[model samples]
Target: MEWQVWLSIAGITLSTFLARSTLLVAGSRLRLPPRVESALRFAPACALAAIVLPDLAYVQGVLQFDLHNARLLAGVVATVFFALTRSMTGTIGLGMCAYWALRYLAGP
Candidate 1:
């Protein structure tokens, strides 16, 4: 609502756009060694794990492992599906469906 807040938002938007676009533009022209290219491929997997690990390990303000925790089970199933199918959208859809089905069958 204030001028400072609006300025801060605009600054952040411009910075983020520049940061991402710079990488996209540079990546096409940049050539790396084979080892570096191979290593860079793991970045996405590590980042995805970092983001997903917390959610899979936590639920309902508490951490517990039980059949009642359908999300954790569904995550495992989804991981296996991803490994086998190597499809992002399919894995996500199947994982979500598994979670909902387990939740429904187990009753809330």
Candidate 2:
């Protein structure tokens, strides 16, 4: 609402926009090394695992590997589905279903 706050918000917005546009402009002509490009392709999956794995595998700061741990159960199901089907969508769907089913039927 104040001038300083408005200026700060505008500055942040402009900075982000300019940074993104600069990358986009440069990316049009940029060609990464094959190894670097291949490595970059794993970034999203690795980042997602980093964020999601702890929650799924931990409970109150402890590792949860028992049957009562619905997340762990779901993760196992998802892992198997991934190995067998090799389908990301199917793995996610089956994993969520397994998690919710275990939660409701077994009582977390």
Give the top-scoring candidate (TM-score).
1
Off by over 4 Å in 2: 1-22, 26-41, 59-66
Candidate 2: residue pairs that collide:
none
Worst 10 residues of 2 by lDDT: 19-28
- The TM-score between candidate 2 and the true structure equals 0.53
Question: What does candidate 2's lDDT look like per residue over 19-82, in tens digits?
Answer: 7798687775888889998899899999899998898889788998788888888998998899
Total backbone collisions for each predicted model: 0, 0
> Candidate 1's residue-wise lDDT over 1-108, tens digit each?
699999999999999989879878787677778999899989999989898877787797787677778889999999899999999999999999999999899874
Candidate lDDT scores, in order, read 0.89, 0.88
Looking at model 1, the pairs that clash are none
